[model samples]
Target chain A: MNPMQRVMTAMGQAEPDRVPLFILATMHGARDLGLSIKDYYSRAEHVVEGQLRLREKYRSDCLNPAFYAAVEVEAFGGETIFIEDGPPNAGAPVLRQDADIDRVKVPRLEDCPGLQRGLEAIRQLKAQVGDDIPILGSVISPFSLPIMQMGFEHYLDFLYGQPERFDRLMAVNQAFCVTWANAQLEAGATAIGYADPLASTTLLPRAFYLKTGHRVALDTLPRIRGSVAIHLGSGRGLSLADDFAATGTVAVGVSAQEDLGHWKLAAGKRFALLGNLNGVEMRRWSAEDAEREVKRAIAKAGQGGGFILADNHGEIPWQVPDEVLLAIRDAVERWGHYPLDWKE
Target chain B: MLRGGADVDELSSDLRCALESLERSQVEKVLEAAIRIHSPLEVIEGLIMPALEAVGEDWTAGKVALSQVYMSGRICEDLVGRLLPAVAQERGSFPRCAIAVLCDYHLLGKRIVLSVLRASGFNVLDYGRMEAPALVARVLADQVDILLISVLMLPAALKVREVRAGLDALGSRTRIAVGGAPFLFDPELWREVGADAMGRSAADGEAIVRRWAGEGAP
Candidate 1:
């Protein structure tokens, strides 16, 4: 089966011929494609070409058009600071005070430069690869979008000291998210990958997740025309598995700190599981070592289906050689098939 | 403020009430209380940490949320910042340390570490979050005696190793220590990252730093 079919099969909780390997892009992919970080940010085609090269090099089952998670925030009026070697960082929030929420206005689909560029990339990818590859478009979730606007501390204060205001801000953020997700879907994204990194243990509790995060996910999922995957980057605990599943995401991106077996049981058969390989480890280890680790992760999580192989987190360092990506792809191909012995 | 025949529960309750009062109290009031307390460590670990943990628990139980915890942590951070200069004035000269969340983008853990270190009389430089190794090496170059790294993610822990490697390559003599939820739960990681020590809580971390400094554990 092709990569798209394999990913769709896995998303449906069915067995694919092999685990659908995906490399959530890192700064490294841009460097590998010889595009400077500035070019990657300023030029839309640079980003698309980098994604295409990474897909071709690793033969990944999924194609992610952008490497950075700050795109949507940038589109929402957050100043973006580009570095020579690292991914762009949204500048210190434009809306620092709680009162500034009234000043915050959602951007139109065409007016958002980053989101527009992202949608165009998705359209281009769909035109190039069509249904042959599952193009996944990404957006920062409401919980994190506020973090981009008001700074982490300020947003947290509004959440606690001024909760009614926080709820209103979240409503506005969620509306934009719905709009963005729909635009991406209309532009040819087969799946929506929502990166809600701050919603994890490092910043919020599982209870807060249900109150604020779950609603955002539920509200945005229906707006997208395809399957939705919630990417909760590392930190916190694996308990988010059930929460993400409860949010009605088709897949939950598990970090390296979490055991896939544990999340699988927590999520049950309701949601597919993606990733747990430590990208930093891959950067430092040999291809052989990476292959061994990838094989172990696949064997552990691929047994009963609902598994798509990917890095536990993004922002992959440039030092991780191309050979390691190939090694990971080869390992998934070798060990990802179903109906295997659990004893192995 | 201990009552006659007070048990652990009563003392804990008293401490909790004291903390709640401090949380609501202006920055000056909290600083004054910190100075007035005989055991600043107890005030920090027993009073402040527990209060923050209670907020965290409230967040976990759904009574509160991230906003609440963030606000509480920020308030506590401000109170600690107010108390630091006075505490340092009383303690006289002390060794300096740099506390940070390392490569991760979460600053709450790093803030707690800074508060504990400052309360313990160490001059602390806090580098917030998502700090690269180069920035850390520059801090080490400034002659900070100890480097305290905290991270919530496993990938960020690897950045700790990168920082360690950078220091090693530079032949810097700064002692390295790491703590956070990930390291707290995974003991073997301390040795894996080659940190001089690791601690589970802010109090424990201060104690470890004191022990490593040859001042006897706090």
Candidate 2:
């Protein structure tokens, strides 16, 4: 089967030709294309070229150029610092105080420069790669969206000090998520990656997560235009895996920090499981070690038909030697075939 | 009458409560009450730092969220800023520059580090998360004794090599000391990123800067 077919099959909870690959890729492409990071991320043409080049080089099953979560943050009153060879950082939040949350107006999603660039890139990527390669667009979930409101510090203060205001702020964030997801889908992204780093268990108590995180995913996932895979962070994501799987998402991005054994039991055939690699360590790993890790991940999570191998965390580190990425793919291809041995 | 000495038990409780609640006023009031008896340095090292550790523990234990961590860390940042002028002179002195590194905006780690550095008597140049090129310009211009590069992302830690090159191009002798989540996880990463050394913690970073200040840059 082809790349898209493999991913779709796995997402469908059925076996594919092999284990599908998924990763959050960016800067690696710019380095390959000899393009400035400025143009690579901001300019649609370069962005498309960058993703295409990476897809070709990595031979991954999906194309998701999640450069940074600040795209929509910039749209909603935050500034973004776009460096030449690095992902952009979210700017100082325009909404600093709890009072400011009241006056906050969601910006026109279509007009947001960051989102527009991504849409154009997605369109170009879709046009060139066609349906054979599934192009995914990423968006920050609403639960964590308020972090961009007045910065993380103030948002936390609101979580405790200003309950009513906090509820309103979340409402506004959910609205923007819905609007942005629809826009990306309309623009050509075949699926959405509901990137919610804030909802992870590392940050919140489960009580808070259920009300805010579970609610946001519940409200937003169903509202998405198509199958949306959720990429969460921290071990808390593991605890919430069952919750996420129950959200009707296509998949849950599992981390190496989490036990893939538990995920096999928790998610089961409900949705596909992607990732489980320690991305930072993979970069610094010896080629031999990197392959060992890849083999280990596939052995544990690549069982049955529900696993798409990838790093459990955010984007691939820009500076990780290209050898590491190649080593991972090579190891998976050699050892990731299904309906065979998983005992080792 | 202003308090003349810190009540170890009373001040500890006050500091703990203020931090647990993240009440700026309570923290200030308790800190102010304690400062009359104890040097702000003593208050930070003895009271505030311990409270920060508790909140940090709570965060790591999953009892708190990023907001709590950020707020609690910010409270400490604010504490140092408020207390530094009074107590900074007592600590040994050094000149340094620090940045949160490019592409990562998580600054609580750097903020706490900056505060601890200031408390350690370093006249730090706060170059808030600028792009590497701009940051390189400031570092070269300032000619600091120690360069504290605080990076949370692996890519940002790797970008330190470029900053190291820029400093080298000028034939400058500035020691680069990297800290933050990434380097803390891998002490050897300091060398990987061309940094002269790695700091295990805020207190450890202070020692790294002091040594670099006296010995000059690598």
What lDDT score is found at residue A220 in candidate 1? 68
Q: Taking the tens digit of each residue's C-alpha lDDT, what string does model 2 give over A105-150? A: 7788667877888888888888888889888888888877777656
DockQ, in order, for the candidates? 0.23, 0.30
**For residues B1-218, could you state the per-residue lDDT of candidate 1 as single tens digits?**
22233343444565455444334465345445444643554455555555555654554344443444444555666666655435455545555667877766556567656654654455677766645666556666667777788876565775677777777777776777887755643566777887888866565666666666676222
Over 4 Å off, model 1:
A342-344, B1-9, B13-86, B89-92, B98-109, B118-143, B147-205, B213-218
Q: Could you say which candidate leads in lDDT?
A: 2
Error of 1 at A235 (Å): 3.4
* Cα TM-score per model: 0.81, 0.80
- Residue lDDT tens for model 1, A184-244: 8889988888888777765566676677777677776777666788887654447666666
List native contact recovery per candidate, as a fraction of 1.
0.11, 0.36
TM-score chain B for all models.
0.66, 0.70
